[model samples]
Target: MGNKRICVPNKKEAPLFSWPWEDLNNYKYLLYGPLVSKVLYSIYKEEINNVDTWCLHILTLFVLRAFVHQLWIIYSNMLFLNRTRRINQQGVEFNQIDAEWHWDNFLILQAIVASLIYLSFPSLANLPIWDFRGILCCLVLHIGISEPLYYWIHRLLHCATLFQQYHWLHHSSKVTSSFTAGHATFLEHLLLCIVVGIPILGTAFIGYGSISLMYSYLLVFDFLRCLGHSNFEVIPYKLFEDVPLLKHVIYTPTYHSLHHADMATNFCLFMPLYDKLWKTINTRSWDLQNEISSRTKSRVPDFVFLAHGVDIISSLHAPFVLRSFSSIPFSIKPFLFPLWPFTFMTILVMWAQSKTFLYSFYNLRGRLHQTWAVPRLGFQYFLPFAAEGINNHIEDAILTADKLGVKVISLAALNKNEALNGGGTLFVNKHPNLKVRVVHGNTLTAAVILHEIPQNVDEVFLTGATSKLGRAIALYLAQRNVKVLMLTPSTERFIKIQKEAPLDYQHNLVQVTKYQAAKHCKTWIIGKWTTPREQYYAPSGTHFHQFVVPPIIPFRRDCTYGKLAAMKLPDDVEGLGSCEYTMGRGVVHACHAGGVVHFLEGWKHHEVGAINVDQIDVVWKAALKHGLNPL
Candidate 1:
């Protein structure tokens, strides 16, 4: 049982020893606000009086540790940076991601402890800022005392009783991120403080301590700890080959990854020398690191879903920022309040670049699937000056996907805007012989909206009646003898769509200019963004089924609102660690699912230009047959 891996739930029974404020959730960070304020005041006091730098040094060290850990987090999630070099190929699920949300709690605990230490010990206070001799003393103490002490304690924790109660929390994450290094129970972290403090305090007891030693020792300790849990192999294998003995002295990300996978081996903190002396090292660590490093080519996916940022804030919902945030349906949170300025700066930087970046990927049915993003946000698609730039990025993505031999590339959200590039028709027309199939996937989007209406309903009100999806929906319903109240101001566009229906059904399609015409209509299909005043025209119990981007708000309590069209992926899908915007786990927008269905059916023709109204039921049935359930 000690060697077995445990899968913790996102919200589960509290382990034996939990953090004091674990119940606070996101607000737990507020617990350290007082200490942070004190640290800031200490900096001001030090500059004015030159009295002591103890509090200032602690603050600087804590900030440095956080910066290093955050850097690793960003680097690990960059899929464009040689994904094959990642140590763990298995995706991290929401359960593990959510559990690690309080990873920085350890640092907060340490800051409070340091404040107490300063108050109690006067001899160690007001020390000089630099001492070269103290650095040598610190290293000696760490190797002689801290290293051996931590190794034995770690091994003891692996015993059955302790493993089940405490150590299991740290090992719960099979796929490690930099934050995983600090993801442990209160007891474990408290013990870690002792192991970390021994070297610093020992140097002070010997009269060799200085502020430089404190910063250097703690920073290196944090840098190495974060490096081991980074889930990406950064330390080159040639270094171990050149030094020979360095393999036993330092641990790599792959070495620590093996320990998480198999709990019985490689049980050392940062250094592999202890594991080697105790015969606990995993035998496969060295060979595996070299194997992952030697991979020169990246995996080419079978299908690609080209997505774009919905807004300035929601754009940070990528896998790298916070998996837990991205895994759930997005909403404005108090925690994100301070990040707006930084996110705005990032948007400005993205606007200057014209590259399509890889966002996330997974494996399904022996084929690789990927999601790529055109660096433009949803609002940018509307600006007249930005249209040409947006189209160029989309075109670049298509040409690149074709070069990589991707079978299908689906344009999603604003990437397929009819006004911008005629639903991706511009690309297909430019490159007539391209192997990759460019798909707007609007057929599936229309099918999802159409099938949602109750079969018993005879008359339905439609908005954006002249649009691609609206036109298809109107003609399809008219052929079934169901009257469609098409809402449009253009008579020529409405006449063109109505004539496509049979003569017997042409009279069933009626064009109405105002929302008042739908006051008596019970079912409303929204293809455009609607205002609350317009929504007031519908009666109680009217359900608004929409294909609009960023979905409209439900202003009326008496009426019902349907989310944007989406489909749940098949259960057999593997490595789907991230959620599509505002969708739950394993759910994707209907257009994205359309591309998957197109690939699975081996369809050859381009799904770009205008959607085929006849293929609506065909694509819907195929999706259902392949286990894509409508949401």
Candidate 2:
């Protein structure tokens, strides 16, 4: 039988459900703000030899814990690695992630308690910086007292009454991340603080404690906790083969995952010795760990949606970071402001590296699909000299996908800009014999926009009329006998698109030079970004439909603004933990769905260069048939 899945039992929120600053949202960080300020002010006052070290130590520990968790998250989610080693294949959705947003609140609570302890016992202050005796005392006390204490308390929490009241929250995440280690009720975390404190306080009260001992012990505890919950198996089984007794000395991620999967077994903190003594260790732990770690290669994706980063701040909205933030439409938030400098540094690092990296992936109808990101930022694409560099990234991604047996690769956002690479025409023409189909996916994009326009509307104002999508839209509408007021400064370009229509229906396409000509028009198709001044020309009831990247600001409150063309994915999609940019769960941009439809239909042709007006309806029909509903 396949690995048995244990469902988390339904439970109400624990009685002690709320965090200190639960409603503060991002401002929750302000709780520790005074502590941080104390550190800086103490340093500025040249008081390093004084009590400032306590705050410094706590701050450093918090940073280190967060770093370790993030490092494990990145490692576990990496697509290029051997994914067969992944323990829990089920995805963590947005709701579960949002519930876990306060995972680190336990650290903040513990730090506050530590501060109170330091104040209560003045003897704990200004301890020696190094003490070899204290280190040994910490290790001894932790293994003897903390490990067994934690194991028993953990088992107790699993008992029906406490499990339903508190522990169920921790077990709720079917696919555990590093943060999963801390996602517990306040009561459980309170118990954890006591379990952790006994080791350090035991050393301190015995006159053996030191700064190094405290820091090292707690940090090691955090590191091991994160490792155990980090769903992917990183520990090698050969170590156990070399030293057979070591399996009881320490626990593996696979061992811990079994606890989540079966619930009644493997209830140890860091050592399996306790579980073995209690006979709670799972029978399949060793076999499964070896099975996963023995694999060398990751599965290949059938399709790749080549996406690019939008901006520095939004970069943190990936599956690895603020997952709660990424699950919804991306917007600038105050909490993200503090992270701008760090994200800016990351941008510098990405600029130096010139490889496409896997961002996220999911399974659709048993076919593996992945999204790869070009390291360049959104604004970088607009730079005059940056075109070649951007194209090089796209070409490299396409060639790499071709080599990896990726059947189709779609260009998203500005990656297929005409000015950048002729809507991906440059690569196809340059390579000439590529096995992988390069799709701009604009046919479905155009179809989504066209369908959004009401059929009863006879006249429409079209901006960016000479552009790829705009041109196709103009031709399609004119052929259907809808009067299209094509707005462009270039009369030559407008006429070129006008002639594409049949000779009988060419009059339906009108060349207009100013937004004033569209004052009487209610249906506005905006392929170009419309400014507030330009938007003012539309009548009060005008509905603005756009295919513009970044989307235009809704300046006219009186008018209704339609979102960018997008489609909801089929219900059968699996492991879709991350949202597609701003789109909600199971929803993706139309171009992304276009690529999915392209793969589903098993088309042999590449959808590059320009859109085929004839295939607009055909691609749209295929998308709907494949369960992609337009949003």
Candidate 3:
């Protein structure tokens, strides 16, 4: 029979055997024979003919077998306990309400009950009904009875009324630790132990059984019970699917934990037979639930504006214009057709007319014929026309320059493919008065090209949003004495470039004081300076020139306050300043009833832009002052 020891709490001190380490030593004894084996060999050598020596050797072997069996059980228990303690100490609170009580007492009760059932089997042979058939019947009975009985009692415990008061406590711990397997109420433990034991014992009594078989089964069962509670995740359950006999066995740790976690399901305790027979098996649910929970916890919204920035440039603005032209009607579109018919005829006529008629009407006090010979200065214009906004700003700047006979240079547009190619130069021959170049190269090559440009290039007009290329260009130009004009669709990018501009410049490039430096001529333009294409295109139109208003140039000061606040202006500014200003060879003049004077002053000083007006005002003022034509 297997050994049994009662553990009374504080009533008697159980022998302290150094626990886990002692368990390891016992395992060594099993693998290599015990110290008594050598002594027995010596005895056999000294007295070869003695009958007592043979009997002693037999006794030693029996003792050794029992010791090894008990030692294996103790070792397995030690492993489970050690793992449980470590997990518990990690501050991993098990949701199970009665975790402490169950871990300490439930397994002990089950072990005791299992031992009793095993020991009781030998007594069946002593009874009046003893035969070979009876013994064979008893072995089968013991093996099959406990599992079904355990299942029924387990199912009953899952009823709502019983679960809330008792079973829920066992399932509260979400992450099932080693010790948590046995963590359940004492009454629940007692019910499981008694219900399972009665059936197995009843069968053992009905059929006579050998005590030794009973002993071996019980010991192995207890050892396996401890193994099931071990934290080691070594076993692969998939390996058992092909083994017909082993596949039907009771209580794999994996299968059992699922039952404890969700009592409403997986009611079978020892085997999945009842679960499968009743159509209650759900092996994949636990993993599925875990996956879904993780996904839910990490969910991110699709329209997070802060992370990706406003889609004004690509999604909202560009699509609106593209769709408007695609849907425009054809009847009234001929009136908006180009008057000129050559390769560059349409563009040249658009530039000349916009300057002579539209610009003169807006800026000059007199009629166009009288103001035809008026002298004007010239200024650099950076028009970013690629994705969200169109090339209308370039058209507008050209018109203004042509009316005043100012010099203009158009930068070639970089498309998505060209930009991605990362090494090439694009040349446009359409406008003889303008020099248009597009840089399509790797960042280092682009940087090198920018560095080669002479420092004497006084003012720079930059178009496009804050990209790595754009930022690098701004930083490089700022290091020289060149003034920068920045324009973009992204407000965040605009803000970031503004902050990085000064630091990016060379430290000793200019030793001028802050006031003098502020007046040292620099301009950055940003915003929807021109009217949107949707305003001009018909719902089903086919032409690109039908885009309205070329592009509008508002002084930065005009839009800095109230509805158009690009960035907040200082409170001291009262109203519009002057309507005319000069920079380089250009003269910028505005007729709007806003802060045109501040814009003009900013143009002369080469300020980033008038805080309240469109940046186009700076370009106009600069061109008019320098006596250069955009055409």
Error of 1 at 10 (Å): 18
Give the Cα-based TM-score of candidate 3 against the true structure: 0.29
Output the better candidate (1/2) by TM-score.
1
Residue-level lDDT tens digits of model 2 in 543-564: 9999998889998989999888
Taken over the whole model, the C-alpha lDDT of each candidate is: 0.85, 0.85, 0.34
TM-score of each: 0.90, 0.89, 0.29
Candidate 3 segments whose C-alpha is farther than 4 A from its true place: 1-98, 101-139, 142-144, 227-232, 285-631
Please give the distance, in angstroms, between residue 325's alpha carbon in candidate 1 and its true position after superposition. Answer: 1.9
Give the C-alpha lDDT of model 3: 0.34
**What clash count goes with each model?**
0, 0, 72
**Residue 210's lDDT in candidate 1:** 88
Cα deviation of 560, candidate 2, in Å: 4.0
- Quote the lDDT for 135 in model 2: 82
